[model samples]
Target: MPFEVREFPEFSWSFSRHKTLLTCARKYGYEYYASHNGWLYEADETAKHAYRLKKLTNVPLAFGQIVHELAEKAVRLFLKHGYVMTEAELIEEGRSMLNRAYLDSRDRKQLWMQKPARYKMLYDMYYKGELNRLEAEDYRGRLHVVFANLLNSRSFQDITTRPLSMQFQQAEEFRFMTVDGVKIFVVMDLLYRDLDAGKWVIVDWKTGKEAENDRSQLALYAYYIMQKYKARVEEIEIRNEYVLSGVNRTYQLMEEDIGLMLEKMKQSIHIMLRYQLDMISNEPVEMDEFPRTEYRQRCETCNHKEICLAQ
Candidate 1:
């Protein structure tokens, strides 16, 4: 076969991407630009390093990811296999996953360093040399609360108990919709039609404390559902299921909210476009064009700190 060149990374927008750009321009460059083709053997060292660091996850994020995975698994099992995972089962499964990840991060340092994409690398382990024992146990202990809350959550109960035939979208499925010729990426935790209420519901499983931007993120998901599913704003209900805290907050989207979100997205895209040397190719300008954040605290926790601080 003839050699085929790799395609350049496509420019896309997501809530996380927008937040990253707002957080620090330099970190955004490392994540979206510098790490583009770092998997190739001939790639420069900086690109390779940035790519590896980008894959690093801390304790909180890893914990949240595990919860999300289990939540998806539970939903699929009930909907497809007619089996519901009990609280005990969920806790056991979560513990097993956590143990395996901890071992991978602790014992497989060499493998992770060589191919970070294929293995887990805890930020605490990489930078601090070890995870604090108390912190690890704390997360482990919270597994019970998390799983219990998940089982008792209003959304979870509603989803599993309702007819499996209800129109629903699976969790963790990467999906996108175009707005004004720009691709907007969205991944919903769960979405289903509430047959009783005659409403389409969008559920976001939150494993962390509620943040100010949580509603905005859900609004974006609501927009995706509205556009692709052709549901009206009046007929849709958005929910933030805070599993850790056992709180479920619901919001009704307005046409005006979506309008504002679109405007915000457009402005963010315009700002990002300014840094591109070639818009068609998504090629970024000089590294310096993306300035480092003045906040030292952000740098302290940044994934690209190794290379970013060096510069």
Candidate 2:
């Protein structure tokens, strides 16, 4: 395969899209292709009803979003100004935010949350200190730890002092030109130049647990920068700060990795193009082509289980 690193491509390949396709083609079809039944006004009654549930998230996903927002705020403050919120402050604010989400979800739980109403119930139980013995103990216990881990990290400390020539902080999805005419979309949490190392650095703060797919995520960011920028960057260093464990995994990219990453992108892009075309033509993808997971246990926790009938 001829690897051509050029200017950024138009909006196309996103991490979520690829992940969805890999996880379940039917889910991907329901999401991206069908726009999660987003036609709304034009959508049939069934589609309109299904679209609402498509976006409903469970506790873990909601909790992760909350953490990401908090971390973004804390990190932005330290970067723009030399201020770090104390651990206590972080915990207090986290609890407060959790409370707010609970109230909001609870008020509207009838419309969205199912019987037992986990969304509203989660906050209600946590305040009552029930998670201490429940299966949710891990999330509650590690809740405030991410603040300390992120604030104390070497790179984070340096971010407070060392100014970069250029930086993109959790900016909107980056869209650019691709040689193959396959557009790519990715939201970079952070990308900046390191004057000392002369390497562009990308940081993606991960929560909860680390997954093997993280490696490719960082690699894709580097691939985007390399293709987008005209400057002759020696290398791009990517960092994954798994806040829950205070683990910082860094990867430096050279020609070897970039070449390999491009190959991977090619495969993903090809599938994406076909899937997109199928959707655009209003062609129904064969259900067997995107079968449910063999692991029935996974469906127990999947948000789409009800809609997909995975079991």
Candidate 3:
């Protein structure tokens, strides 16, 4: 007798999910389908382990998350109170977050949800008495430098200077709608409506280098907003701010571009469906179904490399 495979749905498409599928289908299958069991502390041991592995984050991702969270909070505070932190204050806030998280993970080993990179910095700063240790974790203070760059960057400066009365928003704003049976979700880091220019600005902050995916993500945001607001593609402006490098790229969807991105979304949905059918209903999914990535270099940074074994 065999157990039943879970029924994979077509209606859930997130940028993160799309990214995984684009990166490596095998990894996508592992993350979304194989390792997607719900919390069942009383369930089988194997199930518990799978859930834990699904939730783990690596050092680089952890660092980015920290930066994003603190940045979001700091900006949220500023949007509400017109208060901005100085560089030294930002560094202190970052260190405090790192130190608290480090102590939490250190004391509770199994409950540790953070990566070792953060803990290493905190450990050196306190126990090892190394005052200059943030550099070691983020490599020459890259993390702090990037954070400062964001605080001082023109893009962010605009955010701070804007009056609280004008509608400035954060990622807590999201919209979901079904497009030909596929559910699409979009969240923006900051959204500001400029009545004077008659434009809707959708801003996304990036702590990493520019990539084609970044552009694709902006396209998706534009498409979704066009659908949600029934606004002209020309009225929607998408801004991608790479804070680390102080580079800002803005994109707007033309009428033709909207059609193209929608088609792209449909194509991605079908690709995911093709992989889903192979993985869920069948055992020993054919290698060709969720084909390993041709670019082996990407495997080095992938979290599911061990499971994928993609050369």
**Top candidate by lDDT:** 1
Assess every candidate by TM-score. 0.94, 0.78, 0.78
Ranking by lDDT: 1, 3, 2
Identify the superior model by TM-score, candidate 1 or candidate 2.
1
- RMSD, model 1, all Cα superposed? 2.2
Residue 16 lDDT, candidate 3, scale 0-100? 88
lDDT of 1 at 295: 87
Task: Specify the highest-TM-score model's number.
Answer: 1
lDDT of 2 by residue, 239-309 (tens): 88888889998876677776777788888877766643243343545444565666677656554555578
Give the TM-score (vs. native) of candidate 3: 0.78
Q: Report the C-alpha lDDT of model 1 over 1-311, residue by residue, as the tens digit.
A: 79554545788999888989999999999999888778777877877888999999987888999999999999888888879899999999999988877888999988887788888888888888899789889999999999999989988889677765367766545699888777889988888898778788888899989999898888898888788888899888999999989999999989999888888889999999988888888878888889988887999989889888887
- Model 3 C-alpha RMSD vs. true structure (Å) is 6.2
Ranking by TM-score: 1, 2, 3
lDDT to native, each model: 0.87, 0.63, 0.65
Return the lDDT, model 1, position 31.
93
